[model samples]
Target: MYVLDTNIISELIRPRPNGGVVQWVDTQPLSSLYTTAVTKAEIYYGLHILPMGKQRGDLEQALHQFFSAGLQNRILEFNSTSAMEFAMIASYRRKAGIPISNADAQIAAICSQHGFQLVTRNVSDFAECGIEVMNPFTE
Candidate 1:
């Protein structure tokens, strides 16, 4: 199974999304793709901060429909197992002087707990998180 990171989700909603990313997503079974609550929060936060306008309105509608239709049952939560994974992963990275944002760590934790590969554009951010990561934008 693959968990989509925020960047992948964001790209899918773009008016002219990357062809590579779109192609990659199209080849996967819908049931095999998932997103985390952390990604939801990130997407929502981005939409919330945008100034009210046609762009925002369009994106809001697109995301609403996408989540409701495409990912209703595929949204993963950061449960107890994820939290423990976060603590371990975050602490290890911190001690090693690696700077990973809390959100990325949380997403990584969810992926780790579920044994899911992460689909993201920001591959380096997740490099040492002990989860398989694929950059659909590039490969």
Candidate 2:
């Protein structure tokens, strides 16, 4: 299975017509894709700028369309174990001097723990953390 990084989900929610990554995802088999809690948080963070009156409604509609229909059953939810793994990855990267966002670290840890190929645009960052990455735009 493939775990989608934050940007990939962002593109799906607020689509970029030229986003090759999103297009590539469409070619994958059913149940082959997945999203982590980190991704969901990132998407929600992006949408936080929306007016308060519309935020909830907009987010609900977007999520329903983006996940229910777009990703189907591949939307993986994070559990307590996943959080522990994320903390581990964060510490490892911190000691290694490879600075990265907490969300990215969490996603990477989830992918590592679950043995899922990470679909991301930032390959170098994840590579330094030793997580396998696939750049759909270039692939």
Candidate 2 lDDT score at position 47: 70
Model 1 poorest ten-residue lDDT run: 91-100
| Candidate 2 residue lDDT tens string, 1-139 | 8988876776666634446865797789857888876787777676776777765677668876876786776666667777787788888878888778877877887887788999877788785655679988689
Question: What is the C-alpha lDDT profile of model 1 across 24-77, one tens digit per residue?
Answer: 999999999999999999999999999999999999999999899999899999
> Which of the numbered candidates is closest to the native, going by highest lDDT?
1
How many pairs of residues collide in each model?
0, 0
Summing lDDT over every window of 10 consecutive residues in candidate 2, give the lowest-scoring window: 10-19
Candidate 1 deviant stretches above 4 angstroms: none
RMSD of 2: 2.7
How much lDDT does each candidate structure score?
Answer: 0.94, 0.76
Model 2, which residues run further than 4 Å from truth? 52-60
